[model samples]
Every structure is written in structure tokens, then in C-alpha cells.
Target: MSDERDPSPYDALLLLSFGGPEGPDDVVPFLANVTRGRGIPEERLKEVGQHYFLFGGVSPINEQNRALLAALRADFAEHGLDLPVFWGNRNWAPYLTDTLRDMTLAGHRRIAVLTTSAYASYSGCRQYRENLADALAALAAEGLEPPRVDKLRHYFNDPGFVGPMADGVLTALEELDPRVRDGAHLAFTTHSIPTAAADTSGPVAGHGDGGAYVRQHLDVARLIVDAVREETGIEHPWRLVYQSRSGAPHIPWLEPDICDHLEELHDQGAPAAVMVPIGFVSDHMEVLYDLDTEATAKAAELGLPVRRSATVGADPRFATAVRELLLERAATERGSAVERCALGALGASYDLCPVGCCPARTPRPAAAGADTPL
Candidate 1:
């Protein structure tokens, strides 16, 4: 599968991600693109945009994506995968449509997309597919041959994903003062989606409503904790907490915000803590502001020493994982017997996102589901 002469079934790989502002001027407009139909006021957006403004009005996500792109290209070249990697974002420049146009112009047809989000939720999974659908539709309208896009499966449980996070957690644990390192608690954090969205995360077949999202996170957190325990011989106390909640207060989201969790750990007399941002693939705005800035401040207020581990942005293992996933999918498309790569108890995620998986609140055009591809 790694041989360039063998020819991959897919001609191109698309690195799909959630985009962020590149400059002070791009902050509000980027936020607007993210919250397009939500009716969030400009004033409120400015208030929320303070996170980026604090950092020169730029989001770290774009740079991180660029790094990942470079890493993927390098890995592909080194491994002789012979696939060109293209990048696109959902909410900002180098948009999906533009990238798709470039791919088509280059005469590439079959495409594989690797989204940054590793989970299975409406915003994480379905919304990205919806974006792909929109891009394909636009290309079709322009009389271009819309490519067939196969979204790689959710990789929350893959060793390529978990191994890096485990290493990160270990590094964060080591970063704590030696006196408090043994007593440090692990707070694994992820974006807080609405409870309603949580209720419908995976396929309706085997997994009950919303079970896939929480289950995958729990599995990954357990895997990381176990990996850390095996290496350091410390069974650190840990809990999965949510962050970056954006819905109206009245509407319920995931409970035990990272800040509140820190308070609880402090109350429990935990000497220090390590934040494992297992939910994200990179240190984007949510991670920078929510965890590094806001959560760190709260931990300080509580006198709880804390360290945030690095995200798997452009980690060689992660880039290699992308290549492996692509080949795995290509092998499946070719009807070849290939070992399904995964770690943890739940096993490898389904290659084809099943029918009724990650159902959206409203009907929208989505690609690469059980029946649709675009």
C-alpha cells in the first residue's frame, strides 16, 4: 500500500479543518462565518473575539494546519505514497470550494478528506460533510467534474492518535513540580457541544443515540491514562471535562466545565494538574484561550499548579497516521485485505460513516455518509 508504483485508489488527500482568523482585521469576520445563522450579535462576537485580539487577532489554527500539511507532504514523499495533499478550511480562507476547484483543475478525481476533529458529533462530523457537499454542488454548477470525496473514519481510538496524546499527557505530568507530580490529576478536555447534539453522535444501528461521541472520548482518555500509568507507574486520577461552550446559557451543554473541574480538583486537595486536550488535533483558538489562558488562570486562582500538554499538531506520528489511514481506506476501496488499524477497547471506527450517523438538527446536504458521496 505504501508503494508509489502500486497506485493509490485515491488521487489526492484533502486536509480539512476548522479555520480561524489570520489577523486582527479577520477576527470578527471569521467569527461571523463560524456563527453565520446563529444570530450572534456583533457586540457579543467582539467580546468573544477578545481571545484572538489578545493574541494579535490571529488564531494559531491556520499555522498549525500549514505545519500539518507540510508534515503530511513530507511523510507521503518519504513513504512514496505518491499522493498530493491539499488543504481547506470550513470557516475561513483557502476555503473548501477554492481548494476543490484547485484539485479539479489538477485533474484529480477521487479524493480523501481527513478532518482535524477526531470525534463524532454534529459539528465535528456532519457539519464538515455538509461543507463538502456544498463545495461539490458549487463545482457541479460550474460544469466541473465534482470529485468523489471519501471522509476518513473517526480516528479517536487509533494508536496514531492515542499514542501522541499519551506522550503529551506524560510530558505534562513531568512538567509539574516533582513534589506535586505524583499527586497531580489529569483533566482531559474537549469542546462542549449541546446535549441535543451529543444525543445523536454516531450511527443509529449499534451505538445508541449520542453514545459514539462520549464513548470515543472516554476510550481515548482511558487509553492515554493507561499508557501514562504503564510508563510512569502512577495511576493518576482523571476526568473528562468539557470546554469552549458557546450556546445560550439556558440550553444545556456538557457539564463540569474545565474551570469548574479545576476547582473540584483543588477542593479534593490535588496538588497539581495536567490538562490533556484530547479532543482537538491542534492548539487552536479554543485550546489557546479556553485551556491555556482561561483554565490556567482559574487553576492559578485555586492555587493548583497546572500544565497543558501540546496538541498533536504536525507530529510525525500524526502525519504518518494520516498516510496510514489513507492507505487503509484505499485498500478497502480496492477490495484488498488490510489490517484495520486502531487501539483501545472499542476498536477501529467504521470506514463508511453509517446511515443516520451524526444526524443534524436540520436536513442539510452531506457527503460520504452510508449512501452519499461528493
Candidate 2:
């Protein structure tokens, strides 16, 4: 007899996330960390981050990460998986370098990094790997032998992740009037990156018509749509839309924007709509300001009824999914076969990002991948 839940070869689980400011005073400097080397002026960054000012300059991501950390720890402990969890951010306090240093001091030699972003894109995947390399390099400068890191594969189509989103959509539909609940169209939304980035997302050959980014989102939308139909017996209409775009006017990004899609639904006489943020794992500022604040306002202006679905924030199922990913990866590392869970046609993502999986515009060293320099 053998235990299937053993998470061996990985001494620690690191929750890597895109950090945010916790107060009005920390907003601009945090943005500076995020936008460094982009040459974006401080004034423009301030203008862009005005939404943070709306909530006392706090971005909900840090708190969300805290809750998610607790959930993951609780789930792991409840299941007898004795793994220590640590958290670090790319652009704020408890920054990656500091967290890695702490872990190194604590003698964690093998780390499994689980990024908050659940998709395959430059900003989502490779950038975090690059940051890991940078952090390790900093540790090297201080003569500290950094731990070996391996990023868990993408979980965009994992059942645990999609199931929560599907249920959230169902819940949102129930909030609408009975007359419109059956007819409320679904709008699956995600962040909008530049067209070039989207075109080159994930492995080069895997990019479909709109690229891996769009194709993955479409798969999730279909799965959720089918789930909703099975539960309610109504095959409601749906579309994959983009939101929170931050690019120059001349450059192209994913579309139609969620706000635009809402207006389209209203124009088409759709009774109501549910905005499902499948791309984001937590209700960070992007979902809060972009959907709840900006897009919802647009719907109001159009006299359209709309509801925003909950994200998989601190959801126990998501925590379980993370645990499965860890054990599965550990088995893979030990050269043992394991059952990987995923939804839709995409199957499971690669355990390790290959060379050129999600290349940056400028070449940079990335860790925890086939092309990792460390």
C-alpha cells in the first residue's frame, strides 16, 4: 500500500502574487515598483491608479492573499499534508527577495511556487519566473544559497477552479428577476494585454486564432455555460470579453471590452447579464474597480441590469486544487505517474514552462523553467 497524497521533494509551498498597496501613502511607490523600467511617468501612474485612491488607496489583493494563504494552510493541515506555506509578492511588501531569503534561512531547499495568476501569459507566468531569477540572484550576491524553485503548471481549466466560477454564475443569475434570470447572458471577463503579447502567449504553436490566452478563456466560458445549462436547463448566451486594458491607443489589445459587451447586450435587448471574472483568482482591485466600479457604471448608464459573479478567492475547492497540483508535481518529479485534473479540451498544462513558452519583449533570465538560468 502507498499513500497518494504525499507531497515529497517539495519542502515548502510559496504563494506568489502580484502585490498591491495597503494605504493611500503606499500607492504611488508601489506603482513605481510595478512600472519600473517602463518609463511611465509618476503623474500618469497616479492618474491610472486613481481607483486605488477611491478605496483609501488600498488594493484588495494583499488582503485577498492573506485569506487565500489561510485557506490553503487550513486545507493542507486538515488533510494531513504537513507542508509549510509562505507568501511573497512581485511588487510590494514581503517582496519575493525578502520572502525567499527568509525561506532560505529557514532551510527550505525545494520550493513549489504557485502564482495567483491562473493563466499562461507574459505578465502572468514568465514575468513571475523572471522575478524569481532576480530574487535568487540577489540572494547569490549576499552569498546565500537560494532554494530550487519549480512553478506549478497553469490551472485555468482545473475542475476545482471552474466549478466555483460556474456556481458563482448560477448564484448571480438567481439575483436577477425571475423573468430575466433565465435569459441573462454571461460575460466572461479577463485582463487585456497588448495584441503582440496575446499573439505570442504560451507556447508558440499552441496559440489558436486569438492565441492561447483567448483560447483558454473560451474553453472556460464553454465549460461554465454547459454547467449552467445542466443545472437550470437554459442554454444562455455568452461571450468572452476583455477588460482593464492599459495600453497606448495605437497598440491593440483584447476586446470587446466588458463595458462595451454590456452595452451590446443592452442594445440586443438582453434582459440581464452576469459578469464572470474567470481570469482572476481573487477580487483584487482589477475586478473591484474594473468590473464593479467602471463596467457596472456603464451598465447603469445604459439602463441595463447586471450582476458581477464572485471570484475563486479563498474558496476551499481552489485550495484543494492547489494541494492536488503540488502532490501531482511531486510525483512527477519523482518520475512516478499521477492523475492530473483539468476541465475543457486543453488538458493539463506543462509542469515546467519550456523555452520560449511566454517570451518577454526583451530577453531576461527566468527561473523554474527549461530556460531558467539558475
Candidate 3:
């Protein structure tokens, strides 16, 4: 049992996310932030920035994070948790370094970070930790005392996350013609990272070669499929596909792309299709542009009936789940027994990352884990 008299392990919660442009003029600079080290030219980035221009130069991510932050505050208050949540981003405004400085100045320490990304991979997990380390180092160099940032474990298989996604799939199915609904195929989509990164995502000892990235997605996809089956009594076929791939032309990324898979399904005479973005927590620019714009257009061209499902953004259940995770981790830090809440077969992820869990390409400072070579 936890001692009620003891102080909490965490002073505050930090909502960390990948930021985006909020208006037309900020679009190019936001792109520059995202591709700062990739050696991508400004001209080429401007060309890619057209996607944001098409949507009035706004990315739904920041606003979605705002809604999520509000939901978290409300949930915490309802549950009698006094932890205040602060918002920051890896790129763009309210940047991570600035947020850390503000939090320290506001007297916050031992902060728990919850990134918008929910899966395990270099980009999804390790990169965020590295960013945190960078922020702390920068603060220390400036004689600022930064808080210790511990990230919440991946929640891809949490009931709160899976529940909303399953319901979303059902709702998307309702949009299709009744005559073709029975024959609909589920296409689970996620951001496609390089094959090299995917091959080394999770703990080297237990997760095998493909690591946690592919395995976690497959587990969630199966969970969603089973949930849809249990709810609607339809055992629809499903495939875990990749999307929003961006890198050098020669690098082999995950495949087949969602658009390519849609075309294949069209040729095969599939009656209808539903896209469930199980990988992302919110409908960011990747979801809006890649799936909504590019993939939807391809499906239209192929005469394939398709509907895109919604991400779990600002859902009260998800907000409650976040609170549960925070308390659960706090309990563990206090040496108390806690039953982790998760759906499907993978079980709950580790509260703290293990050594050599998800190594970056080169050596870098990362928080909440041991970066020893496996």
C-alpha cells in the first residue's frame, strides 16, 4: 500500500508532442524545423510544404493537443489528482527547451512526460527521449535546474486507446453502402519508418529482430479486429500497412504503402475498405494529408469505396487512461504493487525503458533508459 503521507514521485505531467504550423506563414519554417538535419533543401521542403498550404497552412495537431491538454486537466481534477500538465513540442512554438525552463522556474521537478506517439521505434520512442536529454543538457549549461523527465510507457494496447479506435472503425463502416459493408476489408495504417529502424525497435533480448514497432502494431490491429468482430459479429479481413514515408529514395522503408495497398484491393474486387489509423493518437498532418488526401484520392480513382476512421483525440476515456498510467507509474516508483491496464496479448509495457531497448543510429544522450550496446 502507498503511504498517503508520502510526497508524490512526480511533481507535474508534461504533454510532449511533435508540433506543426498554425498558419500560412509558419508553414515553411515548420517544415524546416522537421527536416533540420536531413540535408533537405529549402526548395524541396517548400514543395512538400504545399500539403499544409492546401489546408490553409494549418495542421490540426496543435489544436488537437490543446483539446487533449484540457481533457487531461479535467480528468485529473475529477480523480483528485493535483498534478498540473504542461504542454511542449519537439519542434515549433512552445518548444521543449523553453517548456522545461518554464516548468523549473514554476517550481516543478520530477516531471512525467507523455508523448503523443504511442508505439516503440526510433522515431516514436527513442527520439523523444533524446530530445528530452538535449533539453536538460541545454538547461544545465545555462545554469538552470531542469526537472527529471520520465516518459510514460507505450499505450498502443491500452483499452482506452483500443476502445475508441474500435468504435471509430464501426462508425466508418456505417458510412459505406449496406450492400457492400459485409465485404469490407480493414486496412490498418501507420507512419512508415525506415526498414533499418523498424528492425531494431524494442528490447534486443525479448522482442526478436523486428523489435517492438511491427509487433506492437500487429497486436493492436488484431485487438481492433477482434473488438470489431465481437461488437458487430463480422470477421473482416485486415492488413497492417504503412504510410507517410519520407526519406531518401534509396532507403527501404516499410511497405506496402497504404495507397499502393488500396490500389491492389481495388484490382482484387474488394467491395469496400475502411482505413483505421491505429498508429497515431491524433489526426495530425500525416493523417490529414497522407491518408485523407492522398490515399482517399487513390481509392476514389480505383472506384473503391473507402472511409477513414478517426484517431483517439481528446476522448475522455483516453484522458482517464492517461491519469491511470500516471498513478500506476507513481505506485511502482513507491515500491507498491500495481496491476497495469492494457488490452490484447502484449500486456502492459515496462514503466521504465530497459538498457539497449531502442538504440539510435549514433550515440546520443537519452533519458529513462540504459543505452548500452546489445
Candidate 4:
């Protein structure tokens, strides 16, 4: 742990996330909030909302976030950090704008934001900044003050983040039958987006030259695969697969959805498969619906056993990683080059988000009193 005597620069830490519906009645409204300004029809939203209806219109994300909040508070207290933690979501109750308003009213000045996402992409990075901008604008309209907020760097490369996920895969493998464990195929899953969006995702100059999204996914997949192999002494084969595709059929999205991948493995005579949701921090709706419900059903239909690995939600190591990130960011002087702490053998640094990173397609209204570039 970094020196605790160093005066903490941030007044509070904010847990920023993508929220979900808490009950049956909230499902449509939550969906509406997510699809707002997209001009998506109510009927179409109802069709998409069927997945939530399957589980009584409740998404596990809110409960999971609550668990994370508790863990964060406990960790902060244990470390004797004075920063208070707050929760805000892009689409749900205790909304981001409202949360910011409350924080500002309570006299918080400098705040640090920790988004639930671990990667750099439009949805993962820039959109949240845009949301902050929206929230600040809203506060401004109400004649309120917006506190200055700085978001922490991505933690995808942090050992504390990756190690827990690697351990989860190993545990999943152990749960399978001996034969399956010995030769189970590993399927790493993440969300699928339009090929065009992915092509232009990062801020790297030549990023769109094909395979940026796939390549980043491959880097994390390989790290976990290698770690699992080392720990279990099982040389299981693995592949990167996509899930939760929301685009129309005309716009090509990432291929071999988790369900389809499970079917393919079964056809190839694989007796079992271990699915690691490397793309997410928790077992959110995508993980629940796609892996638990849809893919599990497919696996049952094919008589092939499939084990889904756990995400890094509220994992102790994850909290440590967040602390390390904040400390690293705080230690550096403002306007200096950001240095990324590399994960073992990952061969990449994810320090500062590059300028123009993850451009938004349809920008939302700015939040009231959000900090803006001078």
C-alpha cells in the first residue's frame, strides 16, 4: 500500500456504473432510459426486454452494485482512507446527475470516479465522460455547482484484477468432471458491437486497421489461458467469442455468439467447456442471459456440460487494484505523462485515456454542474 500519510487529493470516490431495473415494473422504464433518443420503438424494446422478463424483470446488476459498494466501504475503512464513496448509474435510480447534485450539495469538491468497465472503448470510456458532461450541464441549468471529477485509469492490466479472474477459471475447471477438466475447451466471452464502432474504438493512430477489438480481447484471453494452464497443468484449448449483440442483422457484429459457440464445441466432440466472462466485471444481464440462460440451455440440449466462471465483482484483489490505481494517479503531477503499470506478459500499458478516445454516436444531454475543460 502507498503511504497513507500522503494527503488524499480526492474528497470522495464515486462508483459509476451502468444500472439495471430492480423490479418487474422497472424493466420497461429502465429499457426506455437505455434506449432513449435511439428512436427504438416500444414494441422493439419489449422484445429486447423479454430477457429481463425471464427473470421476473429484475436485473442482478443493482444487487451486485450494492455488494460492491459495501466491499468498497469496508476496504476504504480498513485502509484508513477518508474518502467517502458514492454510487451513480448511467440509466437508473440515484442517477448520475442526481448523485452529482447530492455530492455537490454536501460540499464535495475534488472527486475521483471509478467506472465499472475495465477497457477502453466508446461505451466503456468516452460515453461516461460524455455522461459527466451531460450531468454537469443539467446542474448548470439548475444554477448548481459541479464538482471537479477525475476518472481512474483502466484496471484491465492490473494483476489484482486479472489474477482473480484467472483463479476463477481454475476453480471452474476443477468443478467439471475429471475428463472434462482434463480437456475442457475454454471460451472467453465479451459483448459484441458493430464492426464499424469497434474498428474506430481506441485512440491509437492506426487502430482501425482491422482486429483492434479482437486483438485486445485476445490479449486478455491469452493471459487468463496461460495463467490457468500454469496453475491447473491443463493445456485446455481456448477461443475468443462474442455475446450480447444488440445491432440489426444488416450491420455485421462480432461473430460466434456464446450459444452458437457452445453448439460448435459440442459438435466438435468437446465433452465440456469453461466459459470465462473476461469482458465484464460482474455477472450482469449479458452474462446471466447469454451464458446462464441461453448458452446453458444450449449446452443441455447438446448433452455437453458447461461451467461459467465468476466475474471479479467485490473481489478483494479488485479493491486493492482500485486503490493502487488511485494512488498511482495521485502520485503523478498533473500534465505529466501517465505511466501504466503493466500486467505480467500482457505487453501493454493502459494509463491515460488518449484524446478523442471512444467517440460517441448519439450524444446525450449534459449533466448539470459537471466539470468542463477550460
Distance from true location, Cα of 94 in model 3, Å? 0.8
Whole-structure CA lDDT of model 1: 0.89
| Tens-digit lDDT track of model 3 for 68-119 | 9999999888767888899999988889999999999899989888999999
Any runs in candidate 4 off by more than 4 Å, and if so which?
Answer: 1-7, 209-212, 334-340, 344-351, 362-372
Question: What is each predicted model's overall lDDT from 0 to 1?
Answer: 0.89, 0.91, 0.89, 0.80
Error of 3 at 321 (Å): 0.7
Question: How many backbone collisions does model 1 have?
Answer: 1
Displacement of the residue 25 alpha carbon in candidate 3, Å: 1.5
Q: How many clashes (backbone N, Cα, C below 3 Å) per candidate?
A: 1, 0, 0, 16
TM-score, one value per model: 0.97, 0.98, 0.96, 0.92
- Which lDDT tens digits does candidate 1 get at residues 1-374? 44423436789999999999999999999999999998999999999999999999999999999999999999988977788899999999989999999999999989999999999988999999999999999999999989899999888888778898899988887788899999898999999988878877887854554468888899999998899989999899999999999888999898789999999999988899999999999999889999999999999899999999988889999888888888888888888787988888888888878888888878887898885842
* Alpha carbon lDDT at 22, candidate 4: 84
Q: How many backbone clashes does candidate 2 have?
A: 0
- Tell me the tens digit of each residue's lDDT in model 2 across 331-350: 99999978889889989999
| RMSD to true structure for each model, in Å | 1.5, 1.2, 2.2, 2.8
Please identify which of the two predictions, 1 or 4, would achieve the higher TM-score against the true structure: 1
lDDT score for residue 351 of model 3: 73
